[model samples]
Target chain A: MKPYELTISQAHERLKQKELSAVELTRSVLDRIHAVENRVNAYITIDEKLALDQAEIADGLIARDNMTPLTGIPLAIKDLICTKGLRTTCASRILENFVPPYDATVIEKLKSAGTVIVGKVNMDEFAMGSSTENSGIKITHNPWDLTRSPGGSSGGSAAAVSADMCLGALGSDTGGSIRQPASHCGIVGLKPTYGRVSRYGLVAFASSLDQIGPLTRDVRDCAVMMNVISGHDAKDSTSVPKSVPNYLDFLNGDLKNTVVGIPREYQSARGLDSDVADAVTNAIQTIESMGARCVEVSLPHTEYAVAAYYVIAPSEASSNLARYDGVKYGFRDRDKSDLLDMYRSSRSKGFGPEVQRRILLGTFSLSSGYYDAYYRKASQVRTRIMEDFKQAFEKCDVLLSPVAPTPAFPIGENADDPLTIYLSDIFTISANLAGIPGLSVPCGFSSGGLPIGLQIMGPHFSEGQLLKTAWHFEQAIGIQDRKPEIGS
Target chain B: MKITPEEVIHVANLARLDLDEAVVEKVSHQMGAILEYIDKLNEVDTSHVQPTTHAIFLTNAFRDDLVHEHLERNQALCNAPQRDETCFLVPRIIG
Candidate 1:
C-alpha cells in the first residue's frame, strides 16, 4: 500500500521505526495530490516547496528525539483559515488576491506540532452553499462519483481526505460545512463543541456558530487532531480555558452503559432519502445490540433550526463580513472615484452572487426597521431550538441522526434552487446552534454505492462520550476498515 | 413576509453590492419564497421564550490591551490591486 493509505496512527508508528522518512511520505502524498487534485478540484494552491521544507524540519525534530502527535503528517487547510503569506480566499472574489500577513490560531498550532501543510483546499464562496458549486474559483467533485458534488463549503477538504491527498484537513464548520461534506465524501468530520476550539483568525462567517475542526479517515485520528487543535488561545477571546483531555485514552473505556438518543422528529417521512434513513436506523440497531440503549427523544423545534440558522448566520455575516469594504483589506477596484464609488465598485466586482444575496438578507434582517421582526424573532426561535436539544439530551447521552438528508448529489443539482440548498444542512445546524460537539462517520452505503454517514451529537465538552458512542457503533457495524473504491 | 424587488434593491444598497436588475428580480422572488416558508415560525407560541445569542455561557474573553504590532503596512497592502507609498490607493474620494 502507498504511504498515503496509512491511518495517522500507522503513519506515526512507521515514522518511529524509520520505515518511512518524512520526506518520502510527504513526497508520496504530494505525488498522489498531483495525480488526483485536478480531477477533484481539491486545492486552490499547492505549496510543494513549503511543504517539503516543513517535512525536513519534522525529520530533524525526530532525529533529535522530539516528536509531537502531528509530527511529519501532511495536512490540508480549508481556504477559510488564514495562513501567513498564503493566499486565503475563502473561495470568494472579494479576497481573490488577498494574502494574509499572520497565521490564524489553528495554523500556529499546526506549525508548532510539525504538521506539513500541503495547500489551501477550496470551499463555498464565503461558505454560502452545500455544494462546492458555489466556489467562485471552481467546483469540487465527489470522489465516489465524479458527476456529484463532494459537498461544501469544506468540499475540497473532504475530497482531499477521501482521495488521500493528505493525512487530514482543517475545516471550519459554520453550518454543516465540515460534517455534511465528510458524509458526502465518506470520511470522519468533527465539529468540536463550541469554544473547545478557538475561532481566532478564522475569517468570520457567523462569529458565534463557526468552529475549526478536523476531517480525517477515522475517529481516533479525529480525536488526536482534536487534542492538538482544541484549547484556549489568548488571541481568540471566545476560546474556553478547560483542560484538554487525552481523547485517545477515553476511547478505551467501557461503553456498556452508553445511552444513544434517536430524535423522533428527525425521522421525517417526507424529503428524506429512504437509503439514508435506513442506514441511520440500522446503525442504531447495531449500537443497541452492543449492550447500549436507544431511546426515542424529541427535539420539538427541529423545524425552526434551519430558519433560525439562516437568519442568525446572515445577520452575523452582514456584520462580520463588513470588514472587506475596499479600504483596509482585500480587493479594491482601480477605476472608481469617491469613497462610496470605490466601496460600490470593489464589492460589486469582488463578491459572488450568493455572497451578495446573503449580505442583503443579513443587512435587511439587522436593519433598524426589520431587526425586531426578523433578527430578534430568529434569536428567540434559536433559543427554542437549543431548548429542544437540551431537553432531548436529558433523556439520552448522545443524539444520533443522519448528517445530511442524502449522500452526494450531482454537481449543480441544487445550484439554481437556493432553498433546497439551505435544507441540506438541516440535521447538522442544530448542533452548531446549541454550541455542542457533533461528529459524522461513515455508516453504510446508499444503493447507488455512495456512502451514508450517521451523526453523533453530545453536549458541550462531552466529546469523550461522542467519540465513545461513535467508536462503539463503528465496532458493532464493523465498517471502520472498509475503503472507498476511489483510491483502491 | 414576502420580500419584494424594492426591498432587495434597498438591502443591496446597504450592503454596497451593485446587482443587475435581472439578478435583483430573480433573488427577490427566491428570498420571498424562503421567507414565506420560514413564516411557519409565527404559528409557534414563543412569547415566553428567551433569546439565545451565544450557545456557550461564558462571556468577556478579555485580553491585555497592550499593543501587539503586526505585519509591516506594506505587506498588508501587498495583495491590494492598487496602492501608493503609504496607503492603499483607491479612486479619488472627492469630486
Candidate 2:
C-alpha cells in the first residue's frame, strides 16, 4: 500500500522498523493532498514546506528512539483551533487575514508529540450551520461523491480524513458537527465528553456544548488520538480536573458485558431515511451477536433535542462571538463614521447570512422579557434531556442510534432551509446537550453509494468504553475498509 | 410566539448586523418557525426543573493576582485591521 494509505499504527510500525521514513510518509500524504485537493477542497491552508520541516524533526526523534505513536504522523487540523502563526479563520471572512500569536492547547499538545501539522481544514462560519455550505470561505465536497456534502461545521476535517488527504483530523462538535460529518463521510468521528478535552484555544461556538475530538480513518487511530488530545488543562476553567486514561488500552477489552441501549424514540424519529434505519438496526444486531446485549431504552425527551439545541447553541454563540467586533483583531470596516456604525458595518459585512440569522435569533432569545420564554426555557428542557440520558444509562452501557436521519445529501440540499438543517442533528445533539461522548462509525452505504454512520454514545467520561465498543463493531463489520473513490 | 419583521429588525440591530430590509421578511419567517418549534419545550412542565447552563459543574479558579508575562504587544497587534505601533485604531466614540 502507498504510504498515504497507511494508518497511524501501520505507519508507526514501518517508521520504527526503518521501512518508511516520516519524511517519506509525509511526502506521500502531501502528494495525495495535491492530487485530490482540487476536488476535495479539504484544507484552508497547506504549508508543504512547514510540514516537511516538522517531519524532519520527527525523523531525528525516531532515529534517536525517542518516539510516541503520533511522533511522526501527519494530521490535519480544523481551522477553528488556534495554531500560533497560522491563520485560524474558522472558515469566516471576518478573520480572513487573522493569525494567532499562540497555539491552542490541542495544537500545543500535537506539536509537543512531534506530529506534522499538515494544514488547517475548513469549517462552518462560526459553526452556525449543519453543513459547511455556511462556510464563509468555500464548500467541501464529500469524497464519496463530489455532488454530495461531507457534512459540517467540521466538513473539511471529515472530507480530508475520508479522502486520505490526512490520516486523522481534529474537529470540534457543538451540535453534531464532527460526528455527523464523519457519518456522512464514512469514517470514525468522536466528540469526547464535554470538559474531557480543553477548550482553551477552540474558537467558541457554544461554549457549554462544544468539545474537540478526532475524525480518523478507523477506530484504532481514534483511540490513539484520544490518548494524546484528551486531558484537563489549567488554562480552561471548564476543563475537568481528572487524570487522563490510556485510551489505547481499552481496545483490548471484550464486549461480552456491554449493554447497548436503543432509544425507542430514535427508531421512529420523523424524517429518518429508510436506508439509515436499516443500517442502524443491522448494526444493533451485529453488536448483539458479538455478545453485547441491546436493550430497548426510552429517552422520552429525545424529540426535543433539536429544539433545545437550536436555542441554546445560538444563545451561547451570540455571547461567545460578540468579541469579534473589529476592535482588537479581525476585519474592520474603516469607512464607517462612528464607533457604533463601525461595529455594525464591519460585522454586517464580515459575517455571512447564516451567521447574521443566528446572531439575530440569539439576540432575540436573550432580549428583554424573552429570556424566560426562550433561553431559560431551552435550558430547563436541556436539563430534562440530561435527566433522560441519566435514566437511559442506568439501563445500558451505551446508547446506539443513527448519527443523522440520512447519509450525505446534495451540497445545496438544505442550504436555504435552516429549520430543516437544524433537525439533521436531532440524533447527535443530545450527547452534546448531556456533555456525554458520542462517536459515529461507518455502518453501511446507501443505494446511491453514500455512507451511513451508526452513532454510539456513552455517559460522561466514558470514552474508553465507547471506543472499545466501536472497535469491536469495526472489527466485525469491516466497514472502514470501504474507501471513498474520490481522493485516492 | 410570532416574530414580527419589526422585531426581527430590532434583533438584528441588537446583534450589530445590518440585514437588508428586503431579506427581513424571509429572516423573520425562518426565525419565527424555529421559535414556534422551540415553543414545544413549553409543553413540558419545567417549572420545577432547574436550568442547566453548563452540562458539567465548573468553579472559578482563583489565582494570585500577580501580573504574568502577557502576549507581546507587536504579536497581539499583528492581526488588527487597523493598528498603530501599540494599540488598535477604531472610529471615534466621543466626538
Candidate 3:
C-alpha cells in the first residue's frame, strides 16, 4: 500500500519500526492531495511547506522514541478549526483572508502529539448546510462517485480521508456534519459527547451543539484521534472536567454481554431508503451474532428532532454570528460611509444565502413576541428529546440506527429546498440534542455502490462503549478492505 | 404565508443584513415554509417542561483572578480589514 493509504496505526507502527520516515509519509499524502485535489475539491487550502516542516519535526520525535500514536501520521483538519499562521476559512468568504494568531486547543494538542498538519479542508459556510454546496469556496465531491456529494458540513474532511488524500482528519460536528459525510464516504467518524472535546477555537456555530471529532479509515484510528483531541481546556467553559479514558483500550473486537437498542422510530422513519434500512438491519444481526443482545426501544421524541434542531441551532447561530460585523476582523464593506450601513452591507455581502437564511430564521425566532412561540418552544421539545434518549438508554447500553436516511445523494439534489435537506438530518440530530456520543461505521453499500453507515449512540461520556461497539461491528463486517478508486 | 415580506425584511434588519427586494421576497416565502414545519413543535405539549438552553448542564466556570499571557495588540489586530497602529479602524460611529 502507498504511504498515504496507511491508517494512523499502520503509519505509526511503520514509523516506530523505522520502516517508514515521517517525511516520506507526509510527502506521499501531499502528492496524493496534489494528484486528486482537482477532482475532489476536498481542501480549501493546501500548505505544502508547512506540512513538510511539521512532518520533519515528527520524524525527529520518532527518532527520539518519543512518539504518540499520531506522531508521524499526516492528518487533515476541517477549515473551521483555528490554526495559527494558516488561513482558517470556515469555508466562507467572510473569513477568506483571516488568519488566527493562535492555534485552537485541538491544534495545540495535535502539534504536541507530533502529528503533521496536511492542510485545511472545506465545509458548509459556518457549517449551516447538510451538503458542502453551501461552501463559499467550493463543493467537495464524494470519492465513490464524483457526481454525488460527500455529505457536509464536513464533506471536505470525509472526502479527503476516503480518497486517501489524508490518513485521518478532524471534523467538527454541529448537527451531523462529521458523521453524515463519513457515512456517505464509507469511513469511520465519531462525534464525542458535547464538551468531550474542547471547542475553544472552533468558530462558533450553534455553540451548544458544535463539537470536534475524528474521521478516519477505521474504528481504531478514530480512537487514536479521540485520545489526542478529547479533553477539557480552560479556554472553553463548556468543556467538561471529567476524566477521559484511553479509547484504544475499548477496541477488543468483542460484543459479549452488550445490549444494543434498535430505536423503533428509526426503523420506521419516513423517507428511509430500503438499502440503508437493510444495511442497518444486517449490521444489527451481525452484532447479535457476536453475542450482543438486540432489543427494540422507543425514542418517542425522535420525530421532533429536526424541527427542534432547526429552531435551536439557528437561534444560537444568529447570536453567535453577530460578532461578524465590519469592525474587528474578517470581510468588511469599506465602501460604505455610515457605520450602520457598513455593518449591514458587510454582513449581507459576506454571508452566503444559506447562512443568511439561518440568520434570518434565528432573528425571526428570537424577535419580540415570537420568542415564546419558537425558541422557547423548541427548547422545551429539546428537553423531551433528551428525556427520550435517557429512558431508552435505561434498557440498552448503546442505540443503533442508520447514520442517514440514505447513502450519498447526487450533488444539487436538494439545493433549492432547505426543508428537504433539514429532514435528512433527522437520524443524527438527536445525538447532538441530547449531548451524547455518536459513531458512524461503514455497514454496506447502496445498489449504486455508494456507502451506508451504521450509527451507534450512547449516553454522554460513553465514547468508550460506542467505540468498542463500532470496532466489533467493523471487525465482523468484512468490508474494511474496500477503497474508492480515486487517484489510484 | 407564515412569514410576510415585511416580516422578513424586519428580521433581516434586526440581524443587520441589507437584503434586497428579491432576497426579501424569496426569504419570506422560504421562511414561511420552514416556520410552517416548525409549527409542528406546537403539537407536543411542553406547558410544564423547562426549557433546556444547553444539552449538558454545568455551573459557571470560574478561575483564579490572575492574568496570563494573551494575544498582543498586533496579533489581535492582524486580521482586521482596516487597522491603524493599535485600534481597528471602522466607519465613524459618532460625529
Each model's RMSD to truth, in Å?
1.5, 1.1, 0.9
The TM-scores of all predictions, comma-separated, are 0.97, 0.99, 0.99
Clashing pairs in 2: none
User: Clashes in model 1: which pairs?
Assistant: A338-B92, A338-B93
Give the alpha carbon lDDT tens digit for every residue of A1-488 in model 3: 89998889989899999999999999999889889999999999989999999999999998999999989789999999999999999999899998999999999999999999999999999998888999999989999999999999999999999999999999999899999999999999999999999999899999999999999999989999999999889999999999999999998857888999999989889999999999889999999999999999999989999999999999999999999996898899889999999999999899999999999999988999999999999999999999999999999999999999989999999988999999999999999988999999999999989999999999999999999999888888765555898755
lDDT of 2 at B26: 94
DockQ of candidate 3 relative to the true structure: 0.91
lDDT of model 1, residue A395:
88
- For candidate 1, give the lDDT of residue A45: 83
Give the runs in model 3 whose Cα sits over 4 Å from its true position.
none
Query: What's the lDDT for residue A216 in model 3?
Result: 95
Per-residue lDDT over A378-447 for candidate 2, one digit per residue giving the tens place of the 0 to 100 score: 9999999999999999999999999999889898887678888888888989999999999999999888
Q: How big is the positional error of residue A57 in model 1, measured in Å on the Cα after superposition? A: 0.6
Residue A374 lDDT in model 2?
88
What is each candidate's DockQ, to 2 decimals?
A: 0.70, 0.85, 0.91
| Best-to-worst lDDT order | 3, 2, 1
Clashing pairs in 3: none
- What overall lDDT goes with each candidate model? 0.87, 0.90, 0.93
Tens digit per residue, CA lDDT, model 1, A249-322: 77776667888899888997248899999999998888888888888999988888888888899899988888
